[model samples]
Target: MTPIKDTHPSASSAVESGAPGARVGNFRWVICGLLFFATMINYMDRQIIGVLKPQLSHELGWTDTGYANIVSAFQLAYACGYLFGGRLMDRFGVRRGLSWAAFLWSVAAVAHGLVRTVLGFSIARLGLGLAEGGNFPAAIKTVTEWFPLKERALATGVFNSASNIGAIVCPLTVPLLAAKFGWPAAFYITGALGLGWIVAWALLYDSPETHPRLSVAERAYIEEGRVVTTEAAAPWLSLLRFRAAWAYMIAGLLAGPVWWFYLFWLPDFLQKRYHLTLQQTGVRVGIVYTMAIVGSIGGGWLAAKLIGRGWSLNAARKTSLLVCAVCVTPVFFAASVENSWVTVALVGLAAAAHQGWSANLYTFVSDTMPKRAVSSVVGLGGFVSGIASMGNAQVVGYVVTKTGSYALIFAWASTMYLLSLLAIQILVPKLVDARENERRVVTDDGTSV
Candidate 1:
């Protein structure tokens, strides 16, 4: 990977360029909004099962091991899908890739309503996982295409916060939906919502240069100083040779499980630990995810703010990550806390910090890689994360069964971010863009080759 300097026009330059008739339309933000909604729907579909875990467990007579297996099946399929989905997006572009992914996942989400046995649910979840794996890769790639380096993190955070939004929306609505229409309707409603997003996405999304609605000034602003690569997008396998890829993959491996633990186990934890009903658990889970939304946006903004103050990208991003890591340490004490609300506060802080860490980590791909390769690299990382999450699912299920306690799981969650940070530091010592140093040879006539 080559290190590239950003030559894009500065914010002041963009403002100056938008003179007279050159209106700098803020259409990029409109695209960001679309990505946000897609992600919110993506997560809501996945989170519904977790929110309804107690009801599902009781209804199906599932043991801890059985539930873990269902989750593990999804993770296994998600791992495979992440590898392929990222590459598919790179080859096919976001418009087609995301549309297909959303449609398939939506179908799978609805299929869950028809399943009765654990095996049947596992099959449905596997399908959901396979399709949902494409979401982040496509979203991250879209951000890289539409936003300049300075704004990519904030764009990523803005869209990424949608995951928490989806999580929040799940609890807020799923319980009520299940109560009113039965559990199957919860799946049907969330599943059907994606169909609408799919139609809107197909109608609205396109590359900035190709978008008819984009103004010339806005397109130029987006393209200015971006490294123009003529080489074909790097193969997914080639990304592994770069240390930056390893940094991202390792960080994902360590941190992905923590999020999975929260997503899959948190509601069950509330029910078993505090004896909360479904409605109460939903409210509490919504609160935790709401905090995560704050962290996701705040984390991204903090790094951008630091960059504006002349901090190195490395310093700015890593500093934000370190602060997030420290915030998570308090969660270790959560398992020991006596008051349920205190436990919620501690876990909430940790969840928020994880989102903050994730925002920076996702930005690292866009900051370091060529736009053409961003999706592939992100896919590689997600593939690793999916595998790790699969293992964690099994471990969590087994440990909880044997010990009948969440203490060990909470202890492990608190340490992952710091270790992930260390791996990132070792692998990517400087947050440098890989294409920075490449020189495009020109003929004597000043014509590019």
Candidate 2:
């Protein structure tokens, strides 16, 4: 896909004059806020099932295999949804795509509460996964549109941290809600949050060119690094031919499953191995996700700092990702530990590392692709990730069922980040390539629109 071109009245003047005001606008930060809240809701809805796993198992007479099956169904559907949603967002634009995705997923979340049988739950989870899958592709694409290169990482970090909030909220709130109001009620509550966000989003967000509240300065600032025009959209074939797209997709396929595993099963792992009560597990789980928030922001800051100090964006982003990947090694050791607190600490550290890696990775996509194709590439990558996740889901489900433990799962988790690191390194060795025609469609203010 070709980059989204400048549509603002200042487009030609911004490119020709190199004036300071060419790229003015404040709408991006507001868009970022909307994305952040959406993520929070996305994650909360996704993880409610995880928090209620034990209760569901008891009530439904599910064995470990049965629970795993349901989880697998969600992942399976989610993987497919992401593949479709990403492309849809790229084709239709984020505003419409996200609105549809949110509505579908919110409906699915409520449907989750209505299921009575194993088959029913599986179907509901699949729908939820399908609907929720579009989130990252859309959000990351939005970030690329709204932010400059230097600020992209931090902006992505801020938006990505919402996942941690969702994770934290799921454990802290879902269980209590489930206990007091029943599991179905928990679904309804989370579903309602999505609807509220959808309404607010519809009312508040639009393209920078269209947003009325955007200050002249803010709009100019955002339009600075953009490279395409509204009237002459870039061809999708141009983006599809880029090697960078392949690199980003490979990275996503490798890492997506790792994150999905953590989101779907970590709480159950704590309960099964360490014998923690649901309430106790909830508190510890909250801590793990809380640490993830810290990592996301910190990792983003570090990468931006490295870029500022003359490091190549590739070097800076990959270095941070590799470090985070290595940190996951400790989790394998953590899983073998007998002490509950020590186990929590180690897993928590690993979770934080995952977030840090993810924060930079999200930025990495923005760095590699033109703004127009960001969502499209993200969609394609999400599709790859979705397929990869299916294998991971089935494997983890079968492993947990057969072994009756999370030990093997932890071992796989420990090595996943390292594998992703290698894939990123071997696949895309450079940050910028002159052969790729690194030309910025310069607006007069030195903005690359």
Candidate 3:
């Protein structure tokens, strides 16, 4: 996709134009709130299937491999959509780009209710996967357009936490809805919420440059940070050459599937291991995702607090990631624990840590890339991760079907973050803020490295 010629002010130019006024209004926060709702809907819609899997399998008589094929359909489509969606955002801008994506995905969510066979569900999920791919790339672009560097991570964390909220909504409510009204009702109801989000987004959102409701002071406040970058947005292929970009992809490769497993398989795990029904797994899974909400917001808050107090950007970000990695190691015991709550504690801690790790991971794009390039990089990283996640889902299905054990998967998930962290350290060596540098470092091959 060709990049659109959208004019945007760098922080340096805006700061040069005028000093920020006192007592800034928080219209920017209104935008953040909207993003939170959009993310919440996005996760809730994708996860509805996972919540209904046990019932669906029984009703339709799906084999493990059959269910995995459905998941793989979504993952494959999701990877393709993610790769292209970023460029589409860069080409079309958020208002137009995100609205259509959210709309189409909502339609896909509703479509799930009409399907009865394995092939039908896979087709529906493919549509959902393709449409939902644009969600985060657009959200990150919106943040870069609206918030200054100092508050960007916090804004990301706040919006990112909505995924936890969505996860919470599904397990807590999907099973109940299915029990009362049938599984179709669960998809129909959640998909309708996207209509409300579309209305709010169309009416409320605009870039800071043109937002009529935003105060001039708030506009100044949003542009106060120094945004250093190359003279222009980096071309997509050139960006592929950077170690920073690959570091992000590597991190996604390792961790994205683990998160995906939690999203799609946790209900099954809870059910098989404990012989819990959909409703029982609902309560237990709800508790697990509730803890994740804390990680999403708290992780960002901790790193932001550190930066505000004088830690280097690198130190704050990496230390927080390291802390998350260590917390996840406890998951080694998650599948083996006898007490269900004990297992919840171990898995919950890891789930929470994953979100925290995710918050910082997303911020890496905004911190290191120009505002113009942020979505594209985030999209590419997601594409890589989505591909890995596809294989992960299929393998998980096969393993569980053959072995009837979760211990191996949990053990695999436990080590990913440490390896991800190691890749980030080795590839990035030091975090480079794009706002402070004019060009990416390049190797002798003339590629940015």
Candidate 4:
């Protein structure tokens, strides 16, 4: 049997000296790379349908409402996935939990090719949504586990940027795949990529405790800033008492639908408004997602940089979010902009801001919440966000179908970040680590917990 090493070590010991010249190994980054590709493949599968929406709708005779319902199917399940996925990761461990979710979602993605009706598509999306729910919870939890406090955001930015890459990949490839093969082939091929990823994930991923390739210096680096925790993970009900958790959840509820709207509806908007061909739309969409990649990584970097410069964790995270929020305001005018490139520029800027906002937002959770509860908290936020997304889809479909305008939705997206930030300010006024409070509470209660 493989040895199960202890998760905690003394933060004071090993204190950086490593045989005068021993270097920290990059194996942790290899672990990060695995996460990167897993996330990439995950988004690729998720966005394929959106990329192929125009063609699918035409071929399958889908009205906007029907399509909205399909999207909602995915959103509803995805929301629930966020809830259950987090808890499962906490219970069973992220390594097994994330892989299992990825495998099942891949199978569901493949099933898309077999379906010909709206109801069938909805069912398949439901399955995919539920399975894909594990991705963020697992990724966030793993990052918290593997990285020290300062490096967490940068590592998260790297993986979260993969979402944009996957989004970019879909727009660039899915349409072409449909043109060359068939629509079903797009789903089949994208889904298969995840199946392949599982092999690599299973072979490579282990907790930092037992990873054979980790160097002592690197392991020491990880432990140096991580909060020492051997206590059992707090229950979900218990975690709800914290204001910080609610702040995170509100951020999700406000901003999540906007991202989903961009992901699911942007292509159709291009088709409807610009009258672009499939190829043209894909190229344009790819460009927008590329901008998002910058936001995702840059957002994470900005906060980390501020923290390095002696900013409080709260100040750094919130400051980065403020910048992103201001950047998103330009997108409100995108709908009314007469020039196509101008519209693209505006939308691209906002999309970038959202990704940046997300990278920081995720790091914020790991920064403030105990590592053990990080996944569950994010899962809860995602669940709330998913619920909002489900409603947003319906609203979008009705508005677009009835009014033939997405002006209202884009306008709302522009202001949501500011509101979310306000909520965060009200709830998490300081950025103290929750673990410190946990230790105090345990001591006060005279309990081992």
Poorly placed runs, candidate 1 (over 4 Å): 1-23, 437-449
* Residues 1-449 of candidate 4: C-alpha lDDT, one tens digit per residue: 11124454433354344443246567878888988998999899889989988998899899999999999999999999999999899778988998899899999999999999999999999999999999999999999888888888889999999999999989998887898998999889978899999999898899987788776667776876455666356577667767888999999999889999999999999888999999999998999999999999999899889999999887888999999999999899888987777888899999999999998898888877777778889999999999999999999999998889989999999999999999999998887685464443232234434
* Candidate numbers sorted by lDDT from highest down: 1, 4, 3, 2
Query: Model 2, poorest ten-residue lDDT window?
Result: 433-442
- The TM-scores of all predictions, comma-separated, are 0.94, 0.90, 0.93, 0.95
Badly placed stretches (over 4 Å) of model 2 are 1-27, 230-240, 433-449
Give the per-residue lDDT digits (tens) of candidate 3, residues 271-320.
Answer: 99999877889898989999998998888888899999999989999998
- lDDT, candidates in the order shown: 0.87, 0.79, 0.86, 0.87
The digit string of per-residue lDDT tens for model 2 on 13-119 reads: 55456665545555677889999999999999889888888888898898777777787788778877876787777778888999999999999999988888889
Higher-TM-score candidate among 2 and 3?
3
Alpha-carbon deviation at 348 in model 2, angstroms: 1.2
In every candidate, how many clashes are there? 8, 27, 2, 0
- Which has the higher TM-score value, candidate number 1 or candidate number 4? 4
Model 2's TM-score against the true structure: 0.90
lDDT of 3 at 170: 90
Alpha-carbon shift of residue 154 in model 2 (angstroms): 0.9
